[model samples]
Target: MTITIDRRIYNDSVISKALYWLSGDYLIERSLSDNNTESVTITANSATDISETELETRLMQTLNDFKLRQIVADETRDIKTILYAKAFAEDEDLSEEDIHD
Candidate 1:
């Protein structure tokens, strides 16, 4: 199976994460095009008989999931830092209101 994706729409990190999950069932090869596109080629494991369409669908789904995770992580970075500080700071007397604020 072979697929091409727009680099602007899906970043390298997203592709890498998706490939990591798909690696269990397929041997994935990746390349970049000068036109700002990414090309991915997959060969199913010997024990698997998945079709090209299904593999492409799964790759797209995995890519979407990784993109969502990245968005969530980016959106919550500041909040996560505050949470960590509230949980482990030396001065641990932060009130509920302080933490929320």
Candidate 2:
């Protein structure tokens, strides 16, 4: 099945993550068009009885999950930096309460 995805909504990294997961079940061939769209051709394994529509749905869901994860990571980046800095800091005078705040 041939699936077209909007690059504006789904970036290359997100599509790559989705394809990596689905690659075990399907042979994925991907390409980008001048119109800022991505084309994915998925060929299911002969041993699997998966439908094209089902495969497409799974890919979409995977892409969405990756996008959400990216957003969450971006949002928490500063918090992560703060937590790591606190954990690894060598300041003996620092208290746990200061880190939590």
Candidate 3:
């Protein structure tokens, strides 16, 4: 089955991450279109009972989930870095209250 995804709605990183989960079960190929869209072709490596519509729905859901995760990670990167630094610092005291703050 092949699906075309808008690049504006889903970036390559998110798509790649989502496709990684299905790599073991499917043979996947990707191509770019002139209209700023990505076309992904997915073929089952073995026999399966899933319909194309169901697979498309699942792929869309997975892509959205990964995009949300990517956004969260991007937004919290600085804060996470600080937290990690504090946790590893010998001179800095990382308290439970500090985490809440």
Which candidate's TM-score is highest?
3
The CA-based lDDT of model 2 is what?
0.80
- In model 3, where is the ten-residue run with the lowest total lDDT? 92-101
Query: Which candidate's lDDT is highest?
Result: 3
Report clashes for each candidate as comma-separated counts.
0, 0, 0
TM-score of each: 0.83, 0.80, 0.87
Write candidate 3's Cα lDDT for 59-84 as tens digits.
99999999999999987766786688
Tens-digit per-residue lDDT, 1-101, candidate 2: 89899989988888898789887877889988666898988887667777777777877899999999888787766667667776886563444444433
lDDT at position 47, candidate 1: 68
Model 1 Cα shift for residue 11 (angstroms)? 0.4
At residue 83, give the lDDT of candidate 3.
83
Residue lDDT tens for model 1, 1-100 = 7789998988999989989988887889999876689888888778677777877887899899999999988877667766788788977554455533
lDDT ranking of the models: 3, 1, 2
Off by over 4 Å in 3: 91-101
